[model samples]
Every structure is written in structure tokens, then in C-alpha cells.
Target chain A: MIHPLAVSHDFGVWVGALLTLMVFSFLYRDNPFYKFAEHVFVGVSAAYWMVIGFWTTLWPRVIVPLIPEASRIVSSDTPLPERDLSAVVPAVLGLMMLSRLVPRLSGLARWPTAFVLGTTAGYAVVRYVRSDFMHQIQATIGDGVLIPAAGGGWNVAESLAALVTLSGTIFGLIYFMNTRRGGTVTTPAARIGLLVLMVTFGASFGSAVMARISLLVGRLQELLGDWLGLL
Target chain B: MKRPTPQILLTGVALILVVAAFMAPPGDGSSGGFAGAVTYADRHFSSWFGILAVFAFLLGGASLLRTHGRRVRERKADWHYSAVTLVSFLAVLIVGFLKLGGPPGLTGDPTDASSWLTTIFDSVLSPLHATLYSLLAFYVASASYRAFRARSLETSVLLGAALIVLLGRIPVGVTLFRFDSLSLWLLKVPNTAGQRALMIGVALGVVALAVRMVLGLERGRGGDGS
Candidate 1:
């Protein structure tokens, strides 16, 4: 027996494949096909967000609490105490987000924005001290460097690589430091730091490229196996 | 001389709501008021949004037609490109929406293998996207060559360390130099340490940014422009 969801899923899979291809058509040249796909994606995403925002965020959180529920206790006229006012606080703030839609009331949105920013900054500061500064310092020191080789198998290259990594990390950190003694742009230590940054960026970019290609390969495999049935 | 009542009211509402949200009981798992509401929201929002977005597709198609149709009619330079784009766009839209080439026996089975839309997307679009993404490889190599230069003592040290890491990652680098063990150590110990540090810093930055946004002090929503 055919599952009901299967029909929809299959339709979705084909539609998705076509959309992906349309987006890719940009490589050959920008064309209307790509634009249509892109616009459809955008429109769909926006509409979806609105529905989600109303059903998920607005109705249950705001509406349900406002409705009085039957109390379990006998001789009690009161409904289950309304959900704590605090629970609705974020929703209120979120609602403030809508103020941006109204030109005259848009400035009201700033309060929520500020609240979000302040909390984020506070969190980052707390997190950074432990992770970026202290941990990095402690990590630079390794067991191989400190302990003596008891088994007569002291790995030289391993120790050296560790040392280089440690040095490179330090230099890279220094390169990013904003403080400078003078107007000079090039400093001995700073140059080494920049080099380390460059290598890291290169490796990161290469890895990202490889990851995308791998994903593409996986998609292709699916197309061949399932859609074309060529496997 | 004029007061902004709407602004003040909105701000007041936001402040009250934020405080209320934090104070609400960490509701019982899947049962309590606050927690249940959050869970419900998370589960249902995305699908709801997806449904709404489907309708938005019509708006997008209309916009595309308006913009591109005018360009083609004006005989603009590169008009042929726009013509191709429009044709492909309409073709896919019609096939996919109308379920053309769908299974012969089925009523609404657009996913059938014979579907022209599926064939076009699978054969043409997927590879193009992949190919575009793959271009990053060349850009990365070019950027590295241009950016990675040793000009100072610290830079030289950094370069030396990076070379060790580079050599350690690849099979050729490890086999040629016989530095497999060394590379392993470099990645596990030093790389982890560096990554942790960066993550911590990033976390801190994120927190600060979030706080600023919440407080209404920071402007621009972390974007480049006003």
C-alpha cells in the first residue's frame, strides 16, 4: 500500500532538485530561470516565517495563557493561575519587533534591541575570559614537552611540531591585537603572526570548498540512484 | 514638545514581557505552561512557515516576469540571457506545478521519474550549483599565496609552524617527511587549544553583541549599514 506522505515527499524531492538546478544555472550565466527560483525561495521563506511566527510564537504563548483553565481544587472559583507574567515577557519584546513595520513607531524597537545586545555582550565577556585567554595559555603547554622520555622513545618531530603549533598560535593571536606602540605597520613578531593567519584562512577555505563538493557529490549520487535508477 | 506615546508603550511592553519570560517557572518537561508553549512553537513553526512560503512563490514569479519581460521587450543588451532565464524559469514552474510527465496512472504524483522538471533539475541545476561552489578552491589557493608571507621574526616563526601543520595534514606531506606522529600531536594538542581559545572569544563576542541588541543601545542589528 502506498503511504500518503510518500506521495508528497516524492513531489518535494523532485521540486527541490529542480530548484537546486535552477540556482546552479547562474554558473553558465545569470538568467530568468535562476531569478524565478531565487524569488520563489525568498517568497516562500518569508510566508513560512509569518505562519510559523503566528502559530508557534504568538497563539500558544500569548493566547492560551490569557484563557482561564478549570481549577483542580474543589470550592475554588479561580482558574489555574494564569501563566506567570514573566513567561509572556519575551513575547512582548518580540512583538516590539513588529514596531519596525510602522514608520512612526519603529523607534520603539530599540529597547528590545538594546536588551538583546546588552545580554549578548555580557555573555561574551564571561565566556571569552575562560575560553580565549586562560584555556589558550594552558593549552600551549603539553605533556610531551614537560615529561622526560622514560621508554627511550622520545619523538623529536612530534615535539617540534607541537612547539611550532604553540608558537604559531601565539603569533596569530598577537597579529590580531589592536594595540601598537607606534605608527609602524610592520613589526617582526606581527609579520610572523600575519603569515600564520594567512595559512589558517587558506586551510579553512580549502576545507570549506571540499565540504561543498562532497555535499554535491552526495546529491548527485542520490539523483543517480533514486531518480534515474541507474545504480 | 511632543511625546511619543506609542514608542513609550511599546518599550514598556517589551520590558515587562522580557522580565516575565525570565521569571516564569522552568516548566515541567512537555507538560508545564511555559516549557510546553516553547516546545509547541519550535515543533510547528517551521512547517507552518513552509506552507506560507509556497504561496509567496506566486509573488516571486510575478515579480520575475515583470522585471525580465520588460528587459526582453526593450531589446536590452544581454536580452538573450534574460530570455533564456525566463524560458527556463517558466518551463520548470509549469512542469513542476502542473505535474507534467507525472506517473501515468497516478493523479498527483509529480515526483515520478518521468517528470520533466525532475529530469531537468537533476541533470542541469545540481551540477551547476556544485561547480560554482567548487570555484572556492581556486580562490582559496590564490588568496593563500597572496596573503601568506613572512616579513618579520614572529611571521617567520608563524610560517614555520604553519608549514609543519600543512605538511602534517596531507598523505604526501606525512609520507615524504615521515612526520605522521608529529602532525597528529600538532593537531590534537595545539590545534585544540587554539580552537578552544577562538571559540571562547567568539562566544564572548556573541554574548556582548546579543546583550547590546537586547538593551536597545546598539543600532543597525549588527549589519554593515543603518
Candidate 2:
């Protein structure tokens, strides 16, 4: 007497299949089911992050340190120091951050925002300079282009690769430079930079495609193998 | 000679603390007292900021609820969707809050293996998230087809490179076209070079931004899109 519209009885499979189909339905056109699924996903994810943040971070680091009793309740096994006055600084800053909810007091929120920005900026300067800039430059310049190995044989391929890298990097940077009038030399450098950039972009796009396809394949396998049991 | 406003004072204090925390030397297990305090403060600053972020998240949630609640109340167009959104938000929130089907403790993790929260996460959220992300596959394929037309020399080079790379990643291309070597050479030389250039540029840009913030020249609460 069950209608053909009924889904399978397996709880996990049934729920998963419904959600998967609902999401995939967007391929055809937007509709109510997709909207509902999308909203639920967003809502649940937000809540998940909140709950996770509270349990992992705010509770232990901020709250428990302020109200010593919370430390025992959150984690009974580990012994922690009673009160940390240092936590009060961030706590106050956090409260200041909440002032953004009020229109007039929103200006107060800028303090915490600036704190975060300053921290990120200060840290990023050192990190990016050391890792991205200095390290890359060192790697590029340190390659043995002219100097042969201890064996005294010249590596033709290694030399060619090093030369290409040095030139490509130089030209790429030149291409990014603006506000200067291009000369005959700079024009050729910029064009070579463009060619290098195109190749990079192409490789990036191809890698991205492969990654997306893998994700699609995962969902398809879930639908076929997990829910449908058809493998 | 002018008195600094509360905002400026607060910003200054924040900057000093953050910079101090960043500059604090790592503890080598030999030091204590002020060194220990500095080490502790340095470690906890990020988590303190995380707590602050939680408050921001709370405001975001409150805003979401307010908007959806208003829509549902006023019966605006597509208000049914708003109702769905609110119900969904509340359902997940309440279930997690109550720790339904979870171990009996006030602060017991709601995401325990047997809990409704975990069930919803595993069965509903994971699949929905995966499927939604998978839609990018179709979009990328379509976009690549439309955008990678070989109308010019640069475009042709790009298209050809992309095809070679794509084929190289798969098994059949190695069997037929011997694309692996070409792809490797292209990636190792030009791609790495281009990436290195971009990284250096980005690092410099980040340094500039950081300097501006530290100097109080970036006056938009860091939210002002530059």
C-alpha cells in the first residue's frame, strides 16, 4: 500500500540520499528543496562553529581562567591555575567587540578589530617575509647553474631549469610593475612574463579541475555505493 | 597637545599588547616569573582573540535570527523559506544545546558519537556540504570550455598547456601522448617561477599593510576594504 514516492527505510542512507538529491537538483534549476537544504546547511554549520568554539576555546581559555570553578567542570582530570588576570585583557577587548551591535557604541568595536589587525599584520610581516620572499629568493639564487657537481660533470637539464626559473621569476616581477613607461627591453620581459603567467594559470586550472572532479566522484560514490548499495 | 579619544587609547593599548605578545621570546623551560608570564600571555593572545571572535559570531547569529524572525512575522515574499531557515537553525541549536541522546552531564559534548547532533552532522550536513561543493565540478567544466577558447596566441598556449597538464595527471595521457615529462618541465620551471614571483609580491604587500596598521594609518577598524 506504500506509494512509489517513498524513500528507503535505512535511516542514514535515507537522510543522506535526500540531502544529496536536493543539492544536485540545483543542476536542473533552483527550487524550494534546494533552498531548504542550502539554508539548513548554513544554519547547522554556523551553530557547529559556535558550539565548537565555545567548548574548545572560550570556555577553557577565557571563561575558566576568569571563573576558576569552570575549569574543573570543563575538564575534571587536568589541574589548572585558579585565576589569570591576563585573560581579563582579552575578555575586556571581547566585550568591547560586542559593542558593535549598538549603532553609537560601534566605534568602540574598532579597538578590538585594530588589535586583531595589528596582531595579524605584525605576525604576517615576519612570516611572509621569511617564508615566501626570503626563502623563495634564496632558493632561486642558490641553485648551481654555472658550478658543476663534485663529480665535475655539468648537468645540462639542471642548468637549463635553473636559468628558466631565474629568468621567469625576474620577468614575472617585471610584468607586475606598473606606473613606469615600457622600454624595448622591458616590453620583451613583460611579454615573457605573460607567457610564464599563462602557463602557471593553466596548470593551476587543470589541478583545480582534477580536485573538483574528485569531490564530485566522492558524492557520486556515496550516492551509488552507500545509499543505493549498487557500487 | 590634543587629548586622545577612547578609540585611539584603546587602539594604542591593543597595539602595544599585540606587538609585545608577538615579540615575546619563546619559553625554553629554563625561565620563569616575568618570562613565564610573557610566554603565557603570548600563547593565550590568539585564543583570547578567538573568544572575541565568538562574541562576533554571537552577534552574527542574533542578526540572522532577527532578520529571519522579522521575515516570518511580516510574511514577506519567500517568507516560507525564512520559516524553514529559522526552524532549521533552532532545531540544530536546541538539539545541540540540550545534548539529546548524549551522555548525562551538563557540559558533556553534544557531538558525542551517539548524539543527534553527530547523526545530523554525519547524515545530513556532510552529504549536503559535499554535494553542494561537487556542483563546482559542473561549473568549472563549463567555465573552462567557455573561457579557454584558442582565439589568440596567448589563449592557444594557455589552452594547450591546460590540456597537456590535465592529460598528464591521468593515466591515458602517459600511455598515448607522453605528457608527463612536458607537464613536469612546465610546472617545475615556469609555474614555480611564476608562483615565487607572486609570493614575493604578496609578501611585500602584506608587509606594507601590516606597517600601515601598526602605524595607525589604516583607520577603518581593519574592515575597510582597501
For candidate 1, give the lDDT of residue A160. Answer: 69
Error of 1 at A189 (Å): 2.5
TM-score of chain B of each: 0.64, 0.80
Chain A TM-score by candidate, in order: 0.75, 0.87
| Backbone clashes counted, model 1 | 45
* lDDT, model 2, position A134: 92
Candidate 2: C-alpha lDDT: 0.75
Off by over 4 Å in 1: A1-9, A48-63, A66-82, A142-144, A147-158, A177-185, B1-226
**What's the TM for model 2?**
0.86
TM-score against native, each model: 0.55, 0.86
